[model samples]
Target: MKWMQRARVGSTLTLALMVLFLTGCPKRPEVVETVPRAIAPQGEVGMPAPPPAPKGATSGEKSPTEVAAQSPEAKPTPEVGAVPEAKIAEAEARPEIAAEVKALGLALKDIYFDFDQATIREDSKKLLSENIEWLRKNPTVKVTIEGHSDERGSSEYNLALGDRRSRATRDYLIAAGVEANRISSISFGKERPFVLGHDDSAWQWNRRAHFAVSAK
Candidate 1:
């Protein structure tokens, strides 16, 4: 019986040591799972997202359309009842042109011709001399000589005669020191008559050389 009691005490001590070793080993460090902390995006991390850049604006500046709308020069208004400069200049030039036409009519005269004749008459020489003197005084004035014939001849014949008459007048003016370049001659034949009649009285007036102002 003493041996058996000693065996039992040894077994009890061994069981106590095993129980303490199993319960006291710090519980295998508890296998805790830790999640990685979240980080913000690159440029927008802490900056409050820049207040959302107004509806149509860009980079915190007003949009081009909006800026233009607010500008003073966006829609300019012209003055009421104001004339354009071109219109004003045209209005001022009209009177000057009328004066030029009036002066031309007052300065130049016409000379008459005889039946089937291109040579200048004795009576017309005095008037032609006066015309030559006047032309010499106004060197800058350019004139055209218009020859007209009576309606007695054919259109072709009258036209030829009118051209000869005009050429005769032009030659006379050139001989009296007028520039050939300044005098242009044209023939009307019977197309344009000064006096409208088939009689000699009207025909005399119709056959003439008329001087007209070309330029100054």
Candidate 2:
């Protein structure tokens, strides 16, 4: 009975030591969550991002469209109106051109022709030479060499003869260094006469070349 009691005491001591060892071993902590103090959920956490830039206005400097937006008072800027000096000079030269044409028209009087002949007369040749020189001075001046005839010949024949006469004058002017571009020829036949009389003197005057300037 003493031995049994001693054995029971030893078993009791062993159990107590085992329980203490188990209690001293590390253990996972239990999470105890406390109730959070109530407040308005501070809106949303992240800040609002800035808006994207306008299309084509990627450059740091303001584009034309952007500049207008920033300043409401700004008016629409017009494109520069400009003209070159040469064009202005050309515009100013118009009056001088008209004057030159008038001067040339006045310089040439009527030129006479022989009866039934389309040949350019000697005196008329001198006048043509002077006219050609003037035309050379002003290259832009255009002249129409019109051939006329007296009423004695048939209208058809006179027309043909008149054409030949005007062409002869044009050729002579060309030979005298006047550019072909500056001269032209036409035939009036006997339909129009500067002198209405039927006498030889009138016919002589009628069979001739008349000079006139073109309207600008």
> What are the root-mean-square deviations of the candidates from the true structure over C-alphas?
14.8, 17.2
- Candidate 2's error at 214, in angstroms? 3.0
TM-score for each predicted model, relative to the true structure: 0.57, 0.52
lDDT of 1 by residue, 1-216 (tens): 999999999999999999999997876567789999975444555565344456765676877888888998765335656676656767887656667966875677788899988989888888889888888888888888999999998999999999999899999999988889989999999999999998998999989998988777
Which pairs of residues have clashing backbones in candidate 2? none
Candidate 1 error regions (>4 Å): 1-95
> TM-score of model 1 relative to the true fold?
0.57
Q: Indicate the TM-score of model 2.
A: 0.52
The per-candidate count of clashes, in order, stands at 0, 0
Q: List model 2 lDDT by residue over 69-168, tens digit each.
A: 7897965443445565656777987667777778879976667789989888888878877777777776766778889999997899999988988888
Point to the candidate with the largest lDDT.
Answer: 1
lDDT of every predicted structure (CA atoms): 0.85, 0.80
